[model samples]
Target: MKTLGKTILLAALAWAASAHAVFAPGEKVIVLNSGDGSISIVDPVSRKEEKRVPVGKEPHHLMATPDNKELIVANASSNDLVFLDPKTGDILRRVPGISDPYQIAYSPDRKWFVSASNRLDRVDIYHGADFRLAKRLPTGKVPSHIAFSADSKLAFVTLQESNEFITIDLGKQEIVWTMPTGKQPAGIWMTPDDRHLLVGITGESHLEIYDWRARRMVKRILTGLGAHNFVARGDGRHVFLSNRMANTISMVDQQTLEVKETFPVPGGPDCMEITRDGKQLWTTSRWIRMVTVVDLETKKVLHQIPVGKSPHGLYFQSHAPRQ
Candidate 1:
């Protein structure tokens, strides 16, 4: 019955649509928080702006429900999360009372959402489907970003104030480990195999590669300048780190833990993600209101489409890569 309902809905959309569009499979439509109080939706295929909706002030990261039916924007200045209809750019609802909310992460099972608050030094875990606050998990000073382990058993949050990563055991709902990193660790990513966790430190241009099983930082890969947020390729073979100061994306070899390529991007590449088929990579320039799309194979900019002001975090839905 659920499948039938989806089919019927797709049929209705097809009947109403004008043309067949190629959507990047597993490629999520990324919304950029243009600090000017607007969210810009980027269509990866067309390399064009799909929609721009007015939002709250200083919107940072965004999270979509497991079903992808809803997208929530973390409005840092407004101290709320604004929920929206992903397909139609409609404001559905808003959850309030968060202090300086920054990055957002979903549980592997997509049951819960944990959003980090910079001013409050806490993470608010929300019921994924309902957007209800389930638990308030406390952390160290200036919690920056959050990443969950592959098994979804643990969550690692980077604390900027103390330069440490706090590991939270999801099952027990407790802090199991705290690993220290360089100054002002900002963004983090768990490898595809779930064996290692990569942390990007802002104060220093370094990538901390931690062996999760070993519970320690075994290797530190040096980046060019201002290594901030990052995303891994679909194949998990390479990781792209957004070097904000250098205005480039540094492709690091996951196996060797070495920088393989340093490609130029727009000013202040804050966060990035790859298409599901791993054909194109997209990054949002923080200083500029544009989304830079890079062709993975040729390593060239295909488009620099305008978005909202001060665009920050990005998200992509998983889909079959273009053949």
Candidate 2:
């Protein structure tokens, strides 16, 4: 009787774990393995890697369609965009001829699709409907990240190699302004109010806040070494930043521009995804080939999920807000 009771207890615990995630049949988490040129589809409920899906060469970053129907993976070396079914991780289609698309995004107004050709030092703008190239503006060396104004008329880009930041007038397809910034600016984000832009300086230990309207940097917020990337907590009040070199993730209050919580995570942390309920934080640990999962409620590193080499970007169908 004791043995039977023990088995039932263990089974009950397992059910709770799966129930908490509430994953459907095809629901899974997608991770971009940049070094291996593939993607890992993991079962979120079981937290086990389901399969490795081969994709284009050097798959670096990914994002969902503005309508959230499909997920797009940017393959830099292969110069293509592969669209995947958001729920099942199946390849829907591939659009080729995108030149060195290291990072890509769609503007807030859904009027433009933008790609940064990192290796070619160019920013390519495409018509939202067909993704036909509207204009390719030559930028400083290594255009790394992109953000857009709420109105979708102004697009901001960071040049890592040139240590500069620039804004392009989408209507004219020309760079209206360019200014110097700290070394190695990688990830760029706009604040909730869309008044200021936050730049992650990968070569330093802090981030620079730029007032795009005033055309000047307003302040610097010291996060940690190699502070890069931002993901909001879905509450619209908090944003998380990952410090790759420091192996830490900092949660900053957007209103105060101050970090409220700092949690240590092993391996070089890169891209992040938080659960919809805002209880768990998932980040790709760049160096260790592992995805670090943190229990936000307890502020503890739960466990790391092994994936592919040099995992860079991560996403799931049910996740927290980006802004």
Candidate 3:
């Protein structure tokens, strides 16, 4: 049944028809306040927070559906998902009973959804749009982030506390192997060609590049202290890495595996989103409780909009690809 899984056609069509309410101009940026159990909607024009709405507990990460119609916020402590209007940050619906969904994402193939239960130390594989649980596999500890192969046949999860990375064979519904990572690996990313896997070492000051097909570390680039998360540059040439301890973010060449440049950003940059034209960046500053806007051309912060405590994840309806 896993191989034969498919989304309900009627439901997808209905949702597509109703999606006209989204993708409007003046789309707001949504920031998840993990410490406050609420979210802030920022007016893109003024670069200020316009409104704050309560969502759920410990909402750490979020992503758009494969169809790009709805935004899914994973409320870790609440153990549920809150779907919202991608354009306005309005509540669309809630799906409960998901256990400890700290970081959630849908595979590129649109065949599977994965939740990394950081607290429960497990990974749950859900099939299709209904998100029915298909398998529960326990990881060692603190599964922090996830990235999938382009074909979506494999899922790579980083265990922050265990210092390991694991790959899930989606077709088999099982983890095929576990390998050692750097100290406190948090963010995992795959090159577009799926040739390399970049592991962010949060406990260290560098990134470890692994050849996934060869299952070995190929290169290590010194980024900054406590490299924690990643965001694509939208140009397809480079990707940005945030270093919490160093208070800086490094831009790395995706092909050459070199640190092209590093820029200073204050207060522990976590998750990030970019503008469609690739000129501006909106990132969450966790320790400082602010949503920062940076001018990519100058590599300087343009505005630091105060929101709530511990803003972790961020998104906007019109933005660059999450590559």
Each candidate's number of clashing pairs is 13, 0, 0
lDDT scores in order: 0.77, 0.89, 0.89
Residue-level lDDT of model 2, residues 90-192, one tens digit each, is 9999999888889999988888999999999899999877889999899899998899998999999999999988899999999999978988998888888
RMSD of each: 8.7, 2.3, 11.7
Better of 1 and 2 by TM-score: 2
Worst ten in a row by lDDT for model 1: 18-27
1-323: candidate 1 lDDT, tens digit per residue: 99999999886676224112335332336565647888776655445677787888888887666667777788988888888776545689988876667788788888767788887888777776666777788889999888887777788899998999998877777788899899889888887677888899888878889997898889998886788887776555877888898787898888878899888887788877676657777788888778787877888887788888788867655532211
Q: Candidate 3 — what's its lDDT?
A: 0.89
TM-score, one value per model: 0.82, 0.94, 0.92
Cα deviation of 70, candidate 3, in Å: 0.6
What is the lDDT, from 0 to 100, of the residue 42 in candidate 2? 84
Q: What is the lDDT of residue 246 in candidate 2?
A: 87
lDDT preference between candidates 1 and 3, better one: 3
RMSD of 1: 8.7
Off by over 4 Å in 2: 1-19, 22-25
lDDT value for model 2: 0.89
